[model samples]
Target: MLHIEDLSYETGGRTLVDAVTLHAAPGETVGLVGPNGSGKTTLLRCVYGTLKPSAGQVRVDGTVLDGAKERARRIATVPQDGQSAFELTVREVVAMGRSPHKKFWEPDSAADRLLVDEALARVGVTDLAERPFPGLSGGERQRALVARALVQQPRLLVLDEPTNHLDIRYQLEILTLVRELGTTNLLALHDLNLAAYFCDRIHVLRTGAVVASGTPAEVLTPDLLAEVYGVRAEVAVHPATGAPTVTYLPGPRTPHATTAPASRPSAEQKTSAM
Candidate 1:
C-alpha cells in the first residue's frame, strides 16, 4: 500500500504538482489520467523517489519514503523511457532488480536466476531472456524493463506510461499481468479507454492538481471529460459488459445559445393547440 499526502512540487516559479493526495491499497490498480502537461509524470517521479517533493511526503505502509532503504525495497518503478547504459542481456537486466535485497558485493544466486526467469515468463518475454536489451524493439524493451521491475517483488509498482510505445496486444498483456500479480499499482496512462478497462480507480489531473479521483465509472463522466479534456462526449454504459463507454460528439458548428431552456405557461400551450 502507498499513501501520498499533500504532495507539492515547484520549479522555475511554476508549480508542477500542487497539494495532491491519494493512496493505493494492496491489490488495487489506480490510474493517473490527464492531458499533456498535467503533471502526471512529475507526480510519479516524486512517488518513485527520482524527484523529491517540495512539501508533503510519500509513505509506504505508514513509513515515510524519503531515502529509506527499506521503502526502496518495497517500491519498484518502470519509467516511460527505458534507458540502459550497458549492453546487458535481458536476463541480466532483470536480475538487477534483486540488487536492493543483496549486499553490495553479492553475486547472483540460483534463486535470483529463478526470479529473473519467472519475471520474463510473466511478462511474456521469456524467449528474449538471452537477447541483448539494446537489440530489442521498443515494445520488447519496455517489457524487459517491466520484467526487471517485476523481479524486484515489490509491494507497490509505479509505472509511468508503461504502454507508451506498446501495441494494443502488449499494452493489455502488460496491464493484465500487473493486475494478476495483485500488487498495488499507480500507473500514469494516456489511454482513457485502457484506463477505463483496466484500472479499479482513476485520478484525473489538471494543471498540477487532482481534479477528480474515484472509481472509473465515477471519474470518467462526460462533464469531467468535457471540462478537463475540452471534449464533449456521450457517456453510456456498455450494453454487453455494463462498463462506462465514452463517445465524442462534434462541437457546435456555429455559436449556439448558452442560456437555459425557457419556461412556458400551460395556458399558452392549450390556446396554441385550440
Candidate 2:
C-alpha cells in the first residue's frame, strides 16, 4: 500500500503540489490526469524520492519511507522521460534494479540474471537487450525501463506517462502488463481514455491540485473536461468495457480555465496497490 499525506512541494516560492493526500490500497491502479504543468510530474517525483516534498510524507504499508536505498527496495519508478546517460547495454541497465538487494561489490547471481531476462522478454525488449541504451528508439527505451522496474520487485510502482512514446498496440500491452503485475500503481497519464479504461480510479488535477477524483464514470464528465482542460469534449460509457470513454470535439479553444475546488480527502479515497 502507498499513502501520501498532505503532500506539498514548493520551489522558488511556487507551490507545485499543494496539500495532496491520496492512497492506493493493496492492488489498485490509480491514475493522475491533468493538463501540462498541473504538478503531476512534481507529485510523482516526490513519491519516488527524486524531489523531496517541502511538506507532508510518503508512506508504504503505513510506514514513512526514508533514504534512497530503503525507498528503492519498496518503490520502483519508471520516470516520464527515462533515458540512460551512460553507455550501458540494455541488459546492464535493467540489471541495475537488483542493486538494492545486493552488496556494493556483489556480482549478478544466476537468479538475478534469470529475472532480468524474464522481465526483458515480458516487456518485448529481449531483442534489444544487447543494444546500447542511448541507441534504441523512444518506445524501445520505454519498454526497457519498464523491464528494469519489474526486476526490482517493488511493492509500489510509480509511472509517469508510461505510454508516452508508444503506438496504440504497445500502449495497450504495456498498461495490461502493469495491471497484471498486481502491484500498487500510481500513474500520471495524459490520455484520459486510457486512464478510464485501465485505472481503477482517477484523480483529476488542475493547477497543481486535485479538482476531482472518483471512478471514471463519476469524474470524467464533459463539463469537467471543459473546465479543467479548456476544451470541448464528449464523454460516454463504453458498452463493451463499461468504462467511461472520451471523444474530444473540435471547437474554438475556450479560456474557461478556472479549476474546481480540490476534492477533500476522505477515509475511503481509493488508491491502487501493487
Per-model TM-score, in order, reads: 0.89, 0.92
Off by over 4 Å in 1: 252-274
lDDT of 2 by residue, 98-176 (tens): 9999999799999999999999999999989999999998888899999999999999999999998899999988998
State the TM-score for model 1. 0.89
| Tens-digit lDDT string for candidate 1 (98-168) | 99999997999999988988889988899998888888888998999999998888999999999988998
Worst 10 residues of 1 by lDDT: 256-265
The local distance difference test score of each candidate is: 0.83, 0.86
- Model 1 gets an lDDT of 0.83
